[model samples]
Target: MIRPGLTFKLSILLACIGVLASGATGYYTYRANRTMLVNEAGQSLLTSTELLGQRFSAAIDDVGADALVLASLPSTANVVQTDNGLGANAPREQLAQVYASFMVHHPEDLQIRLITRKHYGLELIRFDRDADGLMRVEGNSLQEKGQFAYVFDTLAFSPGRIYTSPITVNHEYGTHAAEGKPTLRLGTPIADASGTVVGVVIIDIDLAGLLNRLQSDLPSDYRFYLANEWGDFLVHPDASKTFGFDKGRRVLMQDSFSATKPLFDQATSEVLLNGLVQPGQAAGQVLAFVRRPFGSSEGSRFIVLGLARPLQDVLSGATQLGNRIIRMVLIFSVLALFLAILFARALTKPLHILAYAATHLFAEHAMETLPLKRTDEIGILARCFDRLRREIKSQMDVLHNKQRELVHLATHDGLTGLPNRMLFMQKIEAAIAEATRREEGLAVLFVDLDRFKQINDQFGHSIGDKVLAAVAHRLTQVLCSADVAARLGGDEFIVLIEGPRSAEAAPGIASRIIGALNEELLIDGHSMTVGASIGISQFPDDGATAEELLLNADAAMYAAKSDGRCAYLRYRDVIEARKLKREQASEGATEGREAEPTA
Candidate 1:
């Protein structure tokens, strides 16, 4: 049997590797795109649900406002308190007409009534909207509603306070179009002139109609859900699932969506669930739910509103992307196979040369021997390698530059771009060592801004930061080339001045700094004046070490503030004051000893 040559073996190996790589890349890209789309869809659904919940709450508020308007009217209270006699007929008729006009405008309101606390919650004036149109219930047609919770519970509420009832199926007799429909009731109490609870103005809302109005603009693919505080479904995509408690079975929202249980426990105000990790019916959907306050009632009442869209629809773009990726992967695999065969034939001598050059890539003139003159695949590969080597060198240069920048940043303040406290200390230590060797005088100035806190509190921190930056610029302008300045925390700066006349020149430098800061600053169209108190300390005379000099200068700075700010003090004065106080105390002790009895 004849065996394959080296070129054939190499071609087969390279082709297999390319095909595997292309397939893996295609799968990873499809999966990543699909995940991103799913997450975005979940967030979008959540926002829609929140918007729906807000709309529902606003609708309830609107109904309450309308009820308050009616309850405040003179005719409603007049009709409620007066007996159903000839004297009350005109006001009752007027109130009935008002209710009719309101019902005509708000078709979602099934019924509006003036129900009294007396006569077993008698319906004084009632208007019901049915299939035909608005109908006014009169005389015996008006029914007593005191036995109903919407009437009795609402009567107990304080005057002007609105009440909202739980959503339930309306089984009341003679409710016309509202009979047997899901209803929500809103009521506000009416008080007489003496503040007596006379009656209530109640508006019964068709729950389905209200939700339909709220979701009218939503897309057709979106499904809506609503649940009471007890987690019972009030509205659902599937009609059979809604009002399950009324049907003697429980199809609770928490039971349907396990993640939504937190909403019932008040643990979370909203929930987002996706089909990827969920099971059963939720396995191919993205759903979001938000809890909304039902009304301004005294009790803690709330309802959950939700929206859902199919995950398949959300990932449709990702699916198309996956199809394109698959086609590209097939095309690349065939191209890779053809190139592998071509490379197997031409790779022999150049491959050895390229391998040797790669090993010594950084060596001097390693690419000088490449076959760059030939216009074939080997020459193209050599040129590509040269370009890659240049790019690698360029990247190394960029990395080195970044490292130098990081070092500078480590030593400088981010806000003022001046040396920070640590860097200042390092600079001072070096200056102290040089001064000690050369016997040169060095001065340390501790500068503190006057009334900076007041400026910060009045103008805010943004302006204060700008002031600090300007102050730093002024300090740099005022100092000599050899001198160093640094920020030592908030509103405090330290400066190092060296040379022969450092001690004598320290005060002049301090005066110049104070003058620079004292000038009025025109920041953000606000003219403000600032000043500085500086304390000067000299090397060898004040203290030998950097820390000792800084401490002395800080003490002197406090002295300047105590003596009235906007001035400079020297550490020598502080030391003399201490010496004078000690001498005075010693003299007083000697006088006391001489004047005492012998003992």
Candidate 2:
């Protein structure tokens, strides 16, 4: 083969370099843009999911409030006590109209009724929305609901407590629009004047309609998802997948999206899924799921709410940028190929400089090494590299700062900037360990604000929050440098005092805290006075572990409250009182046995 000339070789080599550089740059830029877009979309979806969860909770609360309103009505009680609407036609008719009006305004309310316990939970007056409109059900249309859990369970609860039934399809006959539809029933007991549960005011909520209303304001493209605490899909994009249990099958969120397993396990409160990192059906979507507490039950009842958007929609801008990058790469490669034949010798020096700058891109004063001032193609490339480096470094710095902020937020209370229960437990455990090793004693002071609920009800949570923050501030001020104070959530705080004199110093610190809190506080043009009941538990004497110490301290705090507010009680005193009461009970039992006759 004939040997190639120097110009030809240089041109070919430059052409290869240009093509490789352009391809690599274009690929990396596309990748970076896609990643950025995915991150932003994930955050946006997560926010939407959280907002949806909140809206769902608020909607449930509103429904419960409505049930309360109907339950509290004098006419509702009067009609329920009248027994099958005899001699109570006027009140029953008026209540039916009220129910009809509510159904008219709230399209999600499928049926409203007043059912009494006397007639085996017979529906006295019922209004149901049908194809015609809201209408009253009379005569044979009335059904006995005492056998149903919604009626019996509701009657079990005292008045004013709303009982939420498990969401299920309403198979009850003669339900009109609610028949065979997904339904949630909220029932509250209606008590007579003597405080007896006479009947229940029941409202049947159309689950699908309520969800539609909740998501009405969201984007049309965003698909909504909902699952019960068991991870069974209550709502899904595919209609067949929802309520799979009703069809003698099972469809679970965790099975569909493995990333959501943690949500069902209760390991995490939220989950974010990226399609790029996922497979199968999830491969082209970004999804977020948030766990929301459901109903007013004290149990661990919750629902998982999710929102999903197509990945293609989120990367539309990146797609456009990729197209532009492709065009740019082709143009630059062609230009480099033509110019290489003329400037083959001249380009060597700048190429070395660029390579060195690339290696030291993040090094201090590295920009000085780049030939940015030159009015040449190499200079333009160098300037672009510099810009990229700056942007990358800025992004990294911001990421680090955000990571630190997140760590702080996870451990501290946002409202008061104090260590929260989780962080406090960790610190207390470590302190306890150290104290046990050194044969030293420490004190845990449990502080609870008295009448805080009243303050919240009287002035609202805004003023109450300010008062809590003020209390937290005073707690910090009253404690010594060796001591730590933490908020244990909602008008309660805990303190740990280390050092040899911890047990002796705890009483004084608690007294000071009580004094500090008792001082009048002026907030939002209102003067407010709040008092705290404090309890002290000594290390080794009260408990051997962090949990024990906290429990004992909490018990002592309640004892203080029982004695009177604005006072301090010690765990030792609580234990002694319990022991004395036990002894007294034993003595009474002995006396009763001794007094028993021949048997």
Candidate 3:
């Protein structure tokens, strides 16, 4: 059988295990919750990115349609008029009014330009705004401008039906240096009534505004860039600063090239690899490119629109979610620790009480019972201890009763059933201390029966015992409840009177005791009478200690015996004189005997 102490130790071990297990479980749960939160955040970022891309594409398409409308206007057409004088003298105000109307219709299109092809070369009669908000005329030979060189050299050599190229241009008419601004240029042959091409109409649509507006709707952490087919930076939100003057020039490329360089490398690679316009790409596969070919052109006019988010930013919410999960787990751990301590204390409280009770078992004063109040194993142990306590108490009671009997036998006279000499002296000491404490008087009376020897000699020891019993009974009757009457030995007795009112009180009690003993008789049907001589000593006057009191009382009793052997006497001057005389007579008789005979 396992001891209670060992059982308590095992319970503590099990409780520790439970705490550790709970902590482990809480940590696992926290980690799982954190992972789920991060994954959900990543999914949301991806979804938002796709929606923003669609919105940007729609915005660009809307702006492109408006530019196409302005290109179709006859007033802005590049055809030469049959009547040159009227056409040349036509009011520039009338053309300005038309341009103003176009600007009002397309509020987001920041700039529009018109270029005309002539037999000599390409003449650009462009209406563009300067910083002063005035429309300015820009003219360029088709051979001089690199932007129009693609139209004049390539298409004019091949003589395509209509040609368009998406180009990034710098509007240098103003001091602002609007650098790396993307524009869409459309070139169409101006056909006469006989179907001969007289000139080409060129439309320049500023794509910078469309790209800027598209970038504005993107999230703050996101950045947008448009690059040409050669991986050259075309339209960036910071294009004016990053591509201004000589800056970022090494990274720009013309529109016809396909091999990507460093700056537009990500866009070109995404467009080529994903083939965004291809039909076979999976629906859920993340596409980094969206390609739209412009103006029925083949390769040169294709706009490779790349849309992507940095993997870091897209998964940033995962980091936050993980941290949140960790924080929650930490909080849960703290709570678990707190609860564990509380539960451990609650579980151990009963065991502590039981242990305390068990410790008391070896102490000088043991507890009567264990104080456990639980109903589990601890309570059962307490109940067992209670039973053990009962058994121990039963044995203690038996031993105590036997000890009391032995003490009584050792201190009492067997025949008279009165206190023996040892008990008498002890009682005398107690009485003296009590009288001294109370500042009162106590009387110690030494009692001796006068005819005790004669009764024993004549009627045998059995009759002598009856006489002693009778005298003891009479003494008990005469004494007050506060007095102790003890048989010193045989017929010698002592009575202790506590807190006597006066010396006269002792005499009255003495007289009553003598009278009661004189009336006691009828031992074995033989009438008997005995006289008791009692010598009284007063506390603080006759004696201050038990021995002194007892010796003085004995002296007084002997004096009573010397006087007549019947009446009690208090030790006084007359008794002292008689005692002195008896001592002197005994000495003289001893000297005479010594001198007269050697035998």
Q: Please, what are the lDDT tens digits per residue for candidate 2 over residues 155-243?
A: 99998888888778888988888888988888899999999899998999988988988899999889999998888899998999999
In the range 106-142, model 3's lDDT, one tens digit per residue, is 5444454443444443443444444555354533321
lDDT by residue for model 1 (1-599), tens: 44454557577776677657857688678778877888899899899988888888888888888999999997777778885622347777777788888899998899999888888888888888788998878788878888888888888889878888888899889999998899989999999988888999999998899999999999999999999999999999899999988889989999989789989999999988888757464878988899888675454678998889988898887776689787876687676768777765666677777787899887656788776665666677888998888888889889999998998899998889999998999999998999999999899999999989999999999999999998999999999989999999899999999889798899999999999999999999989987999999999899999999999999999989888889999999978888999999999999999889864
Q: Estimate each model's TM-score.
A: 0.50, 0.50, 0.39
Clashing pairs for model 2 are none
Candidate that scores best on TM-score = 1
Candidate 3 wrong stretches, greater than 4 Å: 1-332, 338-346, 349-376, 406-417, 433-440, 524-526, 576-599
Clashes of each: 0, 0, 0
**Model 1 clash tally?**
0
- Model 1 lDDT-worst window of ten: 1-10
Candidate 2, superposed: residue stretches over 4 Å from native: 1-26, 86-88, 296-300, 324-599
Please give the lDDT score at residue 158 for candidate 2.
92
